[model samples]
Target: MISLKSPRNSAQSNVSPPVKLLGSALIALTVFMLLAPLVAVIPLSFSSEKWFTYPMPGFSLRWYESLFASDQWRGAIANSFIVGTAVTIIATPLGTMAALAISRPETKGRNLLLLLFLSPMVVPVVVTALGFYLFFARFGLANSYTGLIIAHTVIAAPFVVITMLAAFSRFDFRLMRAAASLGASKMTAFRIVMMPLILPSLMASAILAFITSFDEVVIAIFIAGPDQRTIPRQMFTGMREEISPTIIAASVVVIAVVFALMATAELLRRRAAAGLKG
Candidate 1:
């Protein structure tokens, strides 16, 4: 019997520990740089001081209380949830359908279609917002909830399409064929076989779409009316005009919500992977 090691494996084994340590250090530093702002703002949200400051005299929930108590903040929260939910509902089905179409071998102009769907992500957000503003204004959709939802869906659908496309790339088409051979209708096969396999990815995509809508500011600013003010828009207003600790509290709340959504998405991803393996 003869044993052989690949040249790549041998090369990797020869790499020094110091090189790995340097890489690890660099990654840690990058993560710290990204999280630094959140770490600073989170504590400031609990500061007893009325204004933004560090090493507070004492910790207090007064700002959080103020955030909930204020009508503006409450309305913004409501609007954000409304728009985020609406965007998720609208974007998910459209994105999933687009992903399915593009993944099909028989589909024509798949690349072009994908490029169109993902163009929102490539173009500058301000540019996309300006375009939506101008387009919606002509239709009397400016300053309307419908306008805000449509604008958000344009951006968020791409995330769904991309996420599902990745999942679809790994999907086994044989199961759908098996279902079809078993006399299942096209819709029936998709509902029973395809959907179960893709449900986790769908859920993760929906969460991401909702988060995208919730966090979006530029389009919301251009399209949302005073009545449709979202949390991010409200926070922007606070930063420019009020400069209160309540904004910090709102930031903390937003951060918490984002982390929770991300955690859910991660869990769904793991479940999807496990199902595929099973």
Candidate 2:
């Protein structure tokens, strides 16, 4: 039998060496450009010198010690986790529900609703901050954790929705129908069949929502009170007022903790996949 593959298609599928080298070079350059600042910052965070200087005198964890020792910084760290957790809790379910409804083939006004849900992600943070500030001030929520959590949830929900929608796109709806045909209620079908299949995506979305809220400073500045200061807000204030090594140390601490958590999660996911395969 003659091969069905066309020469042009084969040529396109097998990229030229020069093109591949160029693409690899571009990718490496992009990665370096993105990570250079972080690489610089991470080292500086461990510098023994009081001020930022290249070729530091020695390494020290004094900044980290100072950060943990400070009442304000410690409180800010706690507040960050509180707001992030609350935002993740509120946004995850809401986003999942919205995604489920919008992903349905029979859903009406899906595009419009999706746009509405995603408007926060599309709009500028400053614009969202201003709107939240005005709206929150009217209700005496301008300087509260409640306002901060609510504001963060508005922005973070879009990530959850996007992640969930992507998972839903890959999911087979037939399993849901089959469960329903077997006399399972919609809720039962979701819990038994859909949830297990999409649980990884659900976890990912929650993590994204938490990260979004934790990293958000513009909205926190507009909404959070002095008492409810978050890590990002505190970092912003530190940058404006004092460029202390503690700020860099805080960055390192946050980066390390989050990275470790995500790495562990990935390991667990891989193990689960391997076990299932086994």
Clashes of each: 0, 0
Which tens-of-lDDT digit does each residue in 178-256 have in candidate 2?
9999999999999998888778778878888888888888998888889999988999999999899999988887787
**Model 2 TM-score, all chains together:** 0.91
Q: Predict model 2's lDDT versus the native.
A: 0.88
Candidate 1 ranges with C-alpha deviation above 4 Å: 1-16
Question: Which residue pairs overlap in candidate 2's backbone?
Answer: none
lDDT of each: 0.93, 0.88
Off by over 4 Å in 2: 1-12, 261-278
For residues 138-179, write the lDDT of model 1, one tens digit per residue: 999999999999999999999999989988888898999999
Global CA lDDT computed for model 1: 0.93
TM-score of each: 0.94, 0.91
Best by lDDT: 1
